[model samples]
Target: MYSEKLKYYEFFAGVGMARAGLGGDWQCLFANDSDQLKRQSYSDNWAGEAFDSRDVAEVETTDLDGVADLAWASFPCQDLSQAGSKAGIGEADGTSVTRSGAVWPFLRIIRGLAEEGRHPALLALENVVGLLSANSGNDFRSLCGALNEIGYRFGAIVADASHFVPQSRPRVFIVAIRREVSIPAALRTELPQSPWHPQTLLRAHAGLSVEDMAAWVWWSPGAPPPQKDFELEDIVDLSDDADWNSEEATQRLIGMMSELQLNRLAAAKAEARLMIGSLYLRMRPNGDDRNVQRAEIAFGATLGCLRTPKGGASRPRIIVVEGERVRTRLLTVAEAARLMGLEEDFVLPETYHECFRLIGDGVVPAVVRFLADRLLEPLAKHAKEGVFTTINGRKLA
Candidate 1:
């Protein structure tokens, strides 16, 4: 359900996953990425026109055709991911390491778009939940400032795929629209509130609250409510597409564990667990929004935020649910994709590791689609309508 009138340009276009999620109607005027293999994957899935394949940092604005009606950027989160080595803007070994803090370059892209008046009507950004807390929240502030400078208003929500599916993957989605849009007045009337009302994080690290860890904030007063709740079931595939050496890895992990730690893991059916979660989920601050309902804790029903390691074969304990029992295993790439609303049919690379890593590193297709339908389409409509009001002051007719 795309708005045919709008045009799109997918940046950091990983395997054309976003393009696929957004569907066929919206014209893909341009797509950019640095990986040749990923470009091939994209070419296989999308073949009408030849897209530009180059580093986003190198591509000039003049190289692209128009300003585009929408721009999708799930920029590399290596520097901003909690699951990554805590390099904190310092150079590290792995690509996922080294906090490049590249939000500034992306901001330049937006500014370029805005300059030509061909900038997208909506900008959709997705990243690990850690982005909100990394660097004492300075990274987030800079991003907000950049958007404000570009004359766009935005709202961010930290959601998990579990709400839409059954998987416990959570991520933060930021949606921005050009302030010139008029339809938000009507859209604002329909926005929904966060389920876990701005409760502070009980635990504090680098001086941040639980609420600071994950909370949806709206810069635009009239922004629409969140509609991107996904669950594991929505994106879970029934087929096995991974070659998991769980036995060896588990044995090695068990060999490395202390006697007591070994006993705890050995008692469980699954051997490997995500070690990063412990680092990420610490205790909340004292006497903050300390209201824990008798039911939420008992049922483990809180909407767990999405982690950057959702696709890692080696990290984060993977648990499988059966009739009554839950078992643990390494989550498959397909399952990870499904959790993000990216189906196997989307044509990822053949290498299991590459595909899994890439999908895990990418954004949820379903959520992206939801943004396209609910936010992007409406923004475009508002632009086309050319009227603004805090409330429904003008009729489409």
Candidate 2:
């Protein structure tokens, strides 16, 4: 019965990155997002099949297609983001506010489907790592409680995009399974795993209610294969026409750097090869205790994380240092797409705001593929075949 291609639903689907990550092997039965521009981008790329453009809050059980094996939701992170309001997810009674509140509707949909006996076998919710300690850990507990009320057992793993791409985006993925489903012991851990389950997550688990703690799972997706031997130069274009800031502007930016940052830039200049780095504007207290906007330079094996470009501070700047030369420019749309591990031919939104935000707010398809190929698919197969027992680490047929 599980021989057919496993199917999924993409909730909070931004530009269908989840669909892309799931690839052609897994069938995407439906995709939903409230943002119209994101939907337009998805439509252009996906031919507008099985998509709901309305807010998830407005979506009901009847709006979805038939039951799916998995449901993926990369809900908005504004409220839960450490960089944002830090408002948390609010009370779990469905009175969610701001974008972070989107999770409420997402959970509501799952409950709605469950009421009709159409809930997915697995639920994967992706959010910023801040969700681990939001509201002194109460938010995380509430989130799990909501899932428990809907008849699911949940665990989480924190995965960073830098493992697969030239960008540093650490996100938390909470995977919930219907209680009746039997998880393959090989795919779970008796305790939190290193790197995937950090101290904050451990603390959050410690805070769960007795019943919820009993229902908690410790997922073991396993380590992904070694990353590609790629660098910033591979994803970024530095040609003359690629919007490099003028020499004067570049010098002004350099001047804004503190002594420590300039020292870092000088160290980069000493390198033999042309190196690319990211620069951002931050407000720091000047000598007189007044806040002054300063340009901070960051360089490493990967670029900094991508964020929605709502203002100058939110938009990232690329810094190129080849010997004595220093140039800076806003990150390009194509570059942002590449950072998110999108295909070269992927159709991006017409405007930068829509295109950049979609990528920033979306999941890395490569990371999704890693999770699906490693744990999700195998878990689904085991559950469907009714392989409820494992003897000496082998499945019983």
Error of 1 at 179 (Å): 2.5
lDDT of 1 by residue, 252-329 (tens): 434444454434433442424221111012223336767321100101222233344432223323433333333334
Question: Which consecutive 10 residues in model 1 have the weakest lDDT in total?
Answer: 292-301
Q: How close is candidate 2 to the true structure, as a TM-score?
A: 0.92
The Cα error of candidate 2 at residue 327, in Å, is 1.3
Steric collisions counted per model? 33, 0
Model 2 gets an lDDT of 0.84
- Listed per candidate, the RMSD to the true structure in angstroms reads 9.4, 4.1
TM-score of each: 0.68, 0.92
lDDT scores in order: 0.54, 0.84
> Candidate 1: TM-score?
0.68
Alpha-carbon lDDT of model 1? 0.54
